[model samples]
Target chain A: MTGHEERFDSVAAYALGALPPAEAAAIKEHLQTCALCREEYAYLRPAVTAVAYSAEACTDAGSGAVAVSPLLKSRIMKRVRSEAASREAARRIWPAYALAAACVAIAIVTGLTDLSLNRQNDAQRQTIADLAAPDARRHFFAGGEVVTHGGRIYIAMRNLPALPAGRVFQAWTLARGATRVAPSSTFAPGSGGVAVVALPEAATNIAAVAVSVEPYGGSSQPTTKPIAVVRI
Target chain B: MERVRLRDADAFEALYDGYHRLVYGVAMRVLADPGAAEDVTQAVFLKVWSSPALFQGGSFGAWIARVARNRAVDLARSRSSHGESQLDETLVVEEDLEDTALANIDGERVRKALARLPVEQREPIELGFFGGATQDQIARQTGLPLGTVKTRIRTGLRRLRNALEDALTV
Candidate 1:
């Protein structure tokens, strides 16, 4: 109902999420090409987000204080520990090809030629063969996907941001009802933000696969939040 | 956040200890159900642990508050179809407010800033933001014209932004 310029008036409302769906969508579309509107949005957006901080915890009439249950923290930490332990196990189980795949990723990421490039190429070809396997099943996550076939897992991610110095991308896997995620491999993306890792482990019991940025040589556990976690 | 991202359970527990109240309070305000609020609190912290990268950078407080509110509002919408849930994608704050007065803002400061708003301006924002009411619903509930509701919300947010910016400066 408003012109492109007049849409400026809705920035605050838009930031507060007060607009109707159609109107909000219109403003969202308009902001894409309008630097002025986008700037205003960027400015006021924080204030809008900050408003939620005004909320107070509900107080009990008798106790005069309301706090979250202690069990909640325990529950959360329990899950976090479980995930960490799983990833640690995955790291411990890092197979030979997993290391080679990690080497390939590092080679691509750092632009360094590896003496074992030929051996890594064989691993890469194995990944391709696994990808083309009739039994290959693909699982998708946020930035990329995993394909599993005949006990081998092939992971391909695109547009991954460059890792910091002394950091590498590591993969982890979780088996069904298992307490830990097994470290599958570690690799870095090429300049184009592309990474391809191949795991030669049997995929029969694996339930999920994830990728994270870890320190060089990889860690016994994930040292960063996973960039992607694909459930098979 | 750095430690937590490193899969440090202790660091994450410290984060939860510091922010659980804020996250739960925001959810409680929206849902008004202790059980539901607890569930949302748990979900929020779990999300922080599971996907710390989702939080790019900013006032961790404000970011988590928004995450709490969005999750609570989503639950509220699913329980009863009063209004569409605000898309999380749209709610992504592009500019980090880390350098502003809002960076260290707390509940009391924000509450006082909100209280300073004129009742007419404050009511519509509260309705839309916390109550998850659309402008049309706000108009119906408050018996005001739709345009008036929109104007008041816009005006209120601008004033709130200015007030927050001024809170720390003065």
Candidate 2:
């Protein structure tokens, strides 16, 4: 046998009090063939004997064989019986739990696709909510981008009402100098209606924020009046 | 001794019969006052019966000892609020804990002697107090290397034996 297999056999024999039984009686043993294992056992025997003997010295009632009285055993058996009953009760309700879990999974998946595209748009809504101080999530940042940070205005629109095929929506900052609107973000109806039009931060005393429906591509100038506006 | 997870008369009786001494012993060992120990023992078994799931897959003795230990510690702290001193070291806990509790059975000189060893040596001595959890459980719980845990327990035990023997004499 391999060295490891031989070594483990010796220790196992030592642990179980069987080393002498095999060497003294068993015929055709490996230890009889190997002298090294014999020599190791000679030294290991005393060490093992000393260890086995040490546990014997400890003997007070506090040290060994703690008694479990019959009364306690009866109490334990009663608890087990009642707990078994409740576990049966829980097993009976498992079908309802499975059904509830399925419903929750379905709702979670349906909510996923709308999530990614709306995440940034949602953040803009959060900014508005921050300003509005809305108590609820639905009332906050409805949706939009920073139209004015410092003295520059930028607007990003997503999922807004689209123009006829080849048409686009034009957005305006509507401040004093930005009264004359410029070509802003391009939005396709079927494709994602999302983009930012340059709306530079102009006068500090701005009027409002607005989006206007324009022609194919966009209006060379202002055409339709702003569809939605919030007076700042 | 008493059945903790269920409301059954025999279970209650058995639990009361078997563990009353352990619970009382733990409380007495930790709290020292007879009245406080008895009260803590009553409260511990009451909770044990109500929350049986807390001991799921765990040893009954370990679970009961923990409950007794916790309740006793709480009672000891409460007593301190009433102007009593903190629990003394000589409190004689039931044998189950006191047997394995090297510090409790032999006394704190062993613990103090243990504390004198390096941190690496002191930890395995503490591990012996964990009654039922395996060495691997301790390694996983403490996030220590597996070999390190084994070595510390073995090497530290040897040192503790040498030191504790001397300390016991002192």
Candidate 3:
């Protein structure tokens, strides 16, 4: 095992919810960038879970195991069904983007496109202004360079491997004093291993921004250490 | 999970029926309060329903148990009650969780290994896991130095991992 591998017994501590808040948060950030630790964690989770449950010998009602309230089950089931129905409804409808695109096409054809074009130009100018802000910070890591400006993050990278079909590189940010690494956006590299993704909202209170390989549509958490991290 | 993926109400209900106790038990074990545990349990199932895709084909029981424990700990911290000593001997036993956990891990072997643990190592582990105490809290509660508490817990986990490996070989 490598020197860093030796500290992973804390993964057990992490799984058990025994670590102090800041320490736990630090471990989580490290776990995002360490595949070896993630693998060890995956292997140890079931065992630790067994230990956690065995810590309490819950029996049936006659055996002194506390019974869950019957009302809880009904309440849970009711919420689940309601959510499932809503999801089904959502799936059957057209996504907002498609509808918005169609409306824009109609407006342009009707000669009412000036206002829409002006709004798009304003957004483009704002993006340019954000990138040009004097307080912008720039840094580089394994894959490429990152810049944060005016509450927005931009990653320009070359040398990232071409993602397989249905996979993308996800951007993540660890805000100052935050325990969880929040996901920002997703993109795939273009021709010749070049990719650029901008996260307009990733600059708030963030200490660093990173990119990780993830399944298409992105993951809420990184499964492995990032290909690159731009420390703020 | 397949049925859950399909959004089948019957399958969801069946899942709830099977795992409610384990979920509720883990929450109660940590929170030490039935009302809070019940709320956590309900919230957990609701999360499962909303994001069935999060399972990623792992052991369903372990996933739910992990969520239950984390949520319970969060609730305990929010209530500022984690520091209050709440250890109960009846709840914490020498038995292994494998005995009843859905993962079917080897309980007897784990029990034997836990029984063999040095008291110095075992005490901190128990205080941390069963009592929901951090290393600093364990140190304060046991009057052991912080470094000593950290050493004992890490050593205990290392030993437990070794014992588990031995059991797998057997």
Candidate 4:
């Protein structure tokens, strides 16, 4: 057989994961540009995948039938239910934001102007003070600014859409020479879709800052893609 | 899947009930430890619950089985230095299988199909796929040449594939 044909012969082994790494990498690269090999790989894939099913018949040498513990199902369901309840609680709180937003809109429509303007003024002042720090370094992101000064970080964001229930925006930092992002803080925007969150971690050693939407209580790792990332 | 995506616990429970055996079975086969198998099974299902969208499209059974096996293999590798092989993620087909007949295939059908494969072909496949052994390792254990082991696996799988297609159509 030709060299290409010889390589193609290994597709089944590749599908079954029997090929070693170097040979598998070669087949993967070849599949990228070679439609014929891709077709063969696709054809063989399901059959190999079906091999996993044969495992269902796995049995113990002494036991009559190998079965999972009855309690295991309850254990799994308990965690599932707890997560669902957390999600449900998050759903319930979300409507409170909507009601608060509606009340603000009604107040504005009814000419309750001073209260709204005062809140805006306070926000503006905070933004000014944050940006005017003598040592502050400002970096702009998609919808926000991250300002670092006096060993602290200030994140000012605007026009962020309200998150679904059980979800919050979480901030992450990557330390210099570190490969993974570290969890920093979590926050939800106000009814006006604006937030100014302060993080106490020193910014000098930080390489980058990112924000992603995660479930309530946040995750150790970013569960969703980052909405914003700014290099320091 | 759509209901589970909406966080419907009942729907997810139904999914778990239907396939938990296959998942636990795969893990048990690889890990041979009830505790480790249970851990892998829990992790696999939780992953489905948290990231239902990870399964873009395809047979849920096949997708989950692969997930169970891979997770068990990872755990096994972590506990030992045996140099187990891993499923190449790139070769995992997210799209529909070429033979849709295999889409909803269950353990019984597959068990029968595999039983029909020659022992030579079946041995290498079982060792490589479920046991996470490399072709070389399988060759060492079975005292067969590497090329012979490779050929048997290829021929065995092709036969199993045809057998599945024929059985499903019937």
Candidate 5:
């Protein structure tokens, strides 16, 4: 109430989450400069929470129409348990995952076989998602969200087939001798194909992308040649 | 899970354990039909079991409500297409507004109470409860004056709170 009308209106709009992106950004910048509007924004939180909670309370508490059978209850509980078990297993397998990751890195670097440093660079630029069998041509990667919105690579591959599980798939970065394999990446295909792995955002200098099939859970690095390679 | 996946026994059982009634209540309140409510309830639980991953964000109640709202909204659209229908004109399932939240506030009861509200107030409430729209989005979609919509929400909340309070006490 410091006689700042525009500031007041902006705060209200922000509380309602109705401001356009540009306006929202402007208001955010303005608030940093104005103490009055900042205080009001803080005061609006409780009201928003109250509005949300009140709406949720409207359903009737006594309706004979909805009834659950005993047989059905047990079924849902079992599914939850199994999913819980799998999450636990994933958590425990990290050490093995780390060791395997190391071996793959050495193969690509030491073997001096493939100088596909450009593959990693291309991954960032083209935002390549998944790799498939060389002969099998598919634009998008297998089991990945192809975001046509931006030029960045944002792959989220989960549970990809393990290298040792047969067939090697190595992720590489393009630069110089200091080539480092992506540590954040994971691969293991379940019934739905490997778990999704999200690669780094796109950058300039990216030249190529490749995925080679190697030993179980894949080798610490590429064993021979790449089954998939694309020049960006 | 394998067994549950086969027959959806676990998800169905969750449906049986009061979650169904609550979801059914939400759908019926919005769509106002016994058969449609039942259909939505079944679909929500079925989806939950079929792809538990879809609603795996920690807040189970919010996830369930979202699924129920989508089904209800779809039903509402079809009913609207028929024209001049009571927005809440689905089959009347019996209901009592008063019942404890965890004790016996069945789904239909909540739905029936929702049906009693005016659309101006009810639409936003439904969307928020169902997670389809934020308060501001609801105002924009309904074309109600923002202050007026907010007021209606406040009043609606008071009424809903009264009903819930009675239920919890009884």
Candidate 6:
């Protein structure tokens, strides 16, 4: 307790998981020798655990709330089974393939091509979220959320009606204190009235976001009033 | 655990059924994305399946929770490529505290305890723990000195330690 005050703060941070990796690693090493810090960490663990556990039930997505798709389990289980089969096959064929492996190695490499191209697309986007405000007016009972990772933005909408065959929904961003709005992206909803639009730039200091119907492809300037708007 | 280590599908399924929701929830809170939460949840389970030795003799729930949280944080860090140094008030989701970790405890008591802490102490803790901001990021976002942020977090945690104990006792 006498000299442990210096590292005590980090123990608390470690419990909350707010420390960066290097600092967290350094603290973990120190905890092995510092009984005082370990005691402090133990005391904080429960309260922190409780806090994290409480977050389990939070759903801020409102009507657009998304859950882990039931189909995902089947997909994972299928992959697991396939991997197991592959391992077994490799084990049985190892000694035989070991002889000609070097000669056919290039062919085996070519065989694996495009095995995961679709999955790679999903994997690259990473972060996905539903964005909505409580007072947002729903058009045709449609709601949506904005998902972002790095500098990319993906907007996913639900219950949105199909536009005129030649029209598309254009997204606009109203930055705080800016008079002119920036056009974000344009796309038509996909099947089941669900649509996802990926934008090239990160949305920053956005005060309001809206969508409007525009002619085929889209217009540099909105051709009509916004169909829906959410004040960020 | 042994069954899972042996690649028993039934054992793995049971573990997933019991813990997937909690794992998904923790991830949702941190990453605020359902797709990402689902991905993290699947990854956490796969991690358990691939490395069952990590859970041979410990609380399974705690292990999964810790793993879920660590994965979620890692994803959040990647989401914020500039690091978590730019939290604004708009970024804070003001969910009812009762709906949080204090759900099982006396909400009013815990609220009162948190309310009693100085703003300086409470703000940092809230931003760091709940908002997922790092200490350096918190200092930059709040315009507070770096040393001050560290001191406040330490002082705040100490106060919370006392407050939580007292609230639970009462």
lDDT of each: 0.72, 0.43, 0.64, 0.74, 0.45, 0.60
Tell me how each candidate scores on DockQ against the true complex.
0.45, 0.04, 0.24, 0.48, 0.08, 0.16
**Global CA lDDT computed for model 2:** 0.43
- Mark the regions of model 6 whose C-alpha exceeds 4 Å error after superposition: A1-3, A58-66, A81-232, B82-123, B129-132, B145-148, B151-170
lDDT of 3 by residue, B1-170 (tens): 78876677789899988788778877887878888888878778776765565666546666677667767766776678566433221111111122212334433445566778898987787677667788778889999887677677766766776666633321
Candidate 1 docking class: acceptable
Candidate 3: clashing pairs of residues: A33-A225, A54-B97
- Model 5 ranges with Cα > 4 A deviation: A1-232, B1-18, B33-63, B78-150, B162-170
lDDT of 1 by residue, B1-170 (tens): 98877677789889987788889888888998888888888878887876676777756776787778777877887777654333232233333334233556777788888899999998988888888777878899999997788788877877888777754421
Question: Where does the lowest 10-residue lDDT sum fall in candidate 4 chain A?
Answer: A102-111
Chain A of candidate 3 scores what in TM-score?
A: 0.45
Top TM-score model: 4
Tens digits of lDDT, candidate 4, A91-172: 4533344333433332322233456677655544543454454334567677867877656676767688999998988889
lDDT per residue (tens digit) for residues A1-232 in model 5: 4437655655644443334557656767777778777666544422322222332322233543333334333454565566545434433442244223323332332232354766544432332222221111222344332221133432333345445544435544342223533222223433323332334534233344445555544456566675444433
For candidate 6 chain B, which ten residues in a row score worst on lDDT?
B91-100
Stretches of candidate 2 exceeding 4 Å from the true structure: A1-232, B1-4, B81-170
What TM-score does chain A reach in every model?
Answer: 0.48, 0.30, 0.45, 0.45, 0.40, 0.40
> Candidate 4, after superposition: displacement of residue B31 in Å?
1.2
Better of 2 and 5 by TM-score: 5
Model 5 interface Cα RMSD in Å: 10.2
Q: Model 1: what TM-score?
A: 0.63
Arrange candidates, best DockQ first. 4, 1, 3, 6, 5, 2
At residue B151, candidate 1 shows an lDDT of 82
Q: Which prediction has more favorable TM-score, 1 or 3?
A: 1
Better TM-score candidate (2, 3)? 3
Show pairs that collide, candidate 6.
A131-A145
Give Cα distance to truth, residue B153, candidate 5, Å.
3.1
Best by lDDT: 4
TM-score of chain B of 6: 0.61
